[model samples]
Target: MHVLTMLLPVFLAFALMLCKLFNSLRTMEVQMGMGVVLLRYESPSLFWFVIAFQCLVIGALLAIIYCAFFILSNQVMS
Candidate 1:
């Protein structure tokens, strides 16, 4: 019971972060679709910027997931 109380907020926060990350990815997908439509008219630099931003987001997402799993594993082992 005590462990449950301590871990509940962590679980909630993890879920919330995952939800926000997914929402951002969805938004980025929509933007990318629009970007494709405008690619011919847009500057090359703008397209590269979008690609860089996406890579950064994906890297961060991977790192967050790794950390979450590490923490959960540690919790379970202990």
Candidate 2:
């Protein structure tokens, strides 16, 4: 029980971080138009996209690793 109590908070924290990361990256648009005028800007090309994608992948991988370790520790403690 004590093991779970400690590990749960860490899991929640990771879940929140992943949620925020995804929310922030969810809105990557190049153009927004209302009909009166068209506004567009190049935030980043394929290069930037690739970079961001890599970061996301790495972040998720690290989170998974952390989760795995947390579970292992919890099991070992019991």
Candidate 3:
């Protein structure tokens, strides 16, 4: 029970990350179908911005997971 309590945050963070990734991919697919290629050529900055945002989101998720693990380990050790 204690272990599960400690892991709950980690699990939630992972689920959140997966949801974000799936949502982003679906949005991109829809945008592409609607002619994002034209926008890509017209404004390369938008393309790069999207890529950077995705990276930032993933990085933040990873940091959350790391923090959860660190806290869990500390609790277990103590």
Collision count for each candidate, in order = 0, 0, 0
User: How much lDDT does each candidate structure score?
Assistant: 0.55, 0.54, 0.62
TM-score for each of the candidates: 0.44, 0.38, 0.48
Best by TM-score: 3
**Which residue pairs collide in model 1, if any?**
none
RMSD (CA, Å), candidate 1 to true, equals 7.4
Per-residue lDDT of candidate 2, residues 1-78 (tens digit): 554576676667667656544544564432222643211234456535644664676577666667667666677543
Clashing residue pairs in candidate 2 (N, C-alpha, C atoms within 3 angstroms): none
Model 3, position 45: C-alpha lDDT score:
73
Query: Which parts of model 2 are misplaced by more than 4 Å?
Result: 29-78
RMSD of each: 7.4, 7.8, 5.6
Candidate 3: regions farther than 4 A off:
1-39, 75-78
Better of 1 and 2 by lDDT: 1
In terms of TM-score, how similar is model 1 to the real structure? 0.44
1-78 per-residue lDDT for model 1 (tens digits): 454575566666666556544654455431444454324235566655655665666566556657666666577554
Error of 2 at 6 (Å): 0.7
